[model samples]
Target: MKISILCVGRIKEKYWNDAIDEYSKRLSRYCKLEICQVADEKTPDKAPEALENQIKAKEGARLMAKMDPAALKVALAIDGKKLDSPGLAAGIEKAGLSGISHIQFIIGGSLGLSEEVLRASDKRLSFSDMTFPHQMMRVILLEQIYRAYKITSGEPYHK
Candidate 1:
């Protein structure tokens, strides 16, 4: 299986990059992993709802452009379905069994994903109801995916 993390913006901080690299290395054993980043739109402080929507739309367009048409798209949203590690593992396993060779997980910018992006996704997942920094969320998502793989393989790391 091939897993792609398609997100907005870059991870400028070294610590976040390190965490991502660690997970990427660990995940290499299970499947091919790719991290794709799109340019993020600048948002004014205390911006109005309309302006925020516009920014999200621009970012969403960029994400959609990079999306793989044949891959299963999963969007990360606060209101998305919440799943446990085993459940995620089951979903990933099921996808592979069903002949889904690739899965693309989408992480939006600070303003969140646009309606078009959300509608394009095959699944919407939520780590938590509270909002998280998009950069940090990437790391968290990677770790969960790693855990999911471990769980699927009946490995000891998941505990």
Candidate 2:
């Protein structure tokens, strides 16, 4: 049940850090969790197609660098398949019980994931069609993951 979140950019804001820490603490009881924050390429004020691709590719390289070849990889993307909590819980349970031991969730930079990164994922997941700040999305992702675990354990938190 080991979980890893590899994302571009640091969580500089104190409030985002606090929320992430709280979930990390709660999840410690269930599995080992590692959060890898990588440096993000600076975005242009008015990015052109080529410039945006370059930024995403740079961030993609950083994300790919942190990846483990054997881990079950899940990429977060706007166009990815959307799953309910129960569905995600089922997927998580299946992965855990199938001897996968480790799961890596990739949250791309604010500009979005590069084609290469998306292509490498075993699963692509989306919370919504609407966009969110990468920092806040991390917290939300953690909360949903925690909820998924609770559902898996037949715990009351998911009730």
Candidate 3:
């Protein structure tokens, strides 16, 4: 099994990097884990819809190029379906059993994903209805993934 997180922007803070490193290390025991960070386009000072869409399109293109075409692509969206840990584990296991070994998760930038990228995704997953910082989302995503693996393997994980 292989898991890839195709997220926009880099983790500049040391604490964020450290947390990701720790989760990545633990997750390595379960399967191949890759963190693909694409450069986030700078938002314009004017912040017009046209400019926002253009930036999203550029970022979306980069994200699409980085992922495997055959992998199951799941986009993180605010309006996406939210799943519990067990449900997440089951979904991943089912996909694996069905021969989809590679699972790539797409986390969009500040302005969110483009329509093109969202349409290309196989599933849209959400952690909550509330908005979160895109960078912070990465950490939460990693932790959930780690928990999912533990659940699948019947290991001890506290609620």
Candidate 4:
């Protein structure tokens, strides 16, 4: 299976990059992994709701442009379904069994995903109700994906 993470903005901090690299290396054994980033729109401090929405829309458009239409799209949202690690593993396994060769996970910018991206997704997942920094979320998502693979394979790492 091929797994791709599509997110807005780049990880500028070295620590975050290191964490991502570690998970990427570990995940290489299970499936092909790709991380694609889109440029983020600048948001003014204390921006109005309308302005925030506009920023999200612009970022969403950039994300959509890079999306693979053929792949299963999963968007990450605070209100999305919450799943345990084993559940995520099962879901991924089922997708592959059903002949899905690729799964693309979308992570939005600080303002969150636009309606267009959310509506286009096959699934929406939430790690927690509390908001997280998008850069940190990338590493967390990678680790969970790795754990999912390990769980699917009945490996000891998942514990």
Using lDDT as the measure, the top candidate is 1
Ranking by lDDT: 1, 4, 3, 2
Of 1 and 2, which scores higher on TM-score? 1
Model 3 vs. true fold: TM:
0.97
Q: Where's the lowest-lDDT run of ten residues in candidate 3?
A: 42-51
Task: Compose the digit string of candidate 4's lDDT tens values, residues 1-159.
Answer: 999999999989999999999999999999999999999998889999999999999999999998888999999999999999999999999999999999999999999999999998999999999999999999999999999999999888736
For candidate 3, write residues 18-127 as lDDT tens digits. 99999999999998999999999989787989999999999999998997889999999998999999999999899999999999999999999998899999999999
What lDDT tens digits, residue by residue, belong to model 1 across residues 21-125? 999999999999999999999999999999999999999999999899899999999989999999999999999999999999999999999999999999999
**Candidate 2 — number of clashing residue pairs?**
0
Task: Work out candidate 4's RMSD over C-alphas.
Answer: 0.8
Query: Per-prediction TM-score, please?
Result: 0.98, 0.97, 0.97, 0.98
Residue by residue across 1-159, what tens digits does model 2's lDDT show?
Answer: 789999989988999999999999999998899999999988879889899999999999999989999999999998889999999989999998899999999999989999999999999999999999999999999999999989888888845
Model 1 spans with C-alpha error above 4 angstroms:
none
lDDT of 1: 0.96
Output the better candidate (2/3) by lDDT: 3
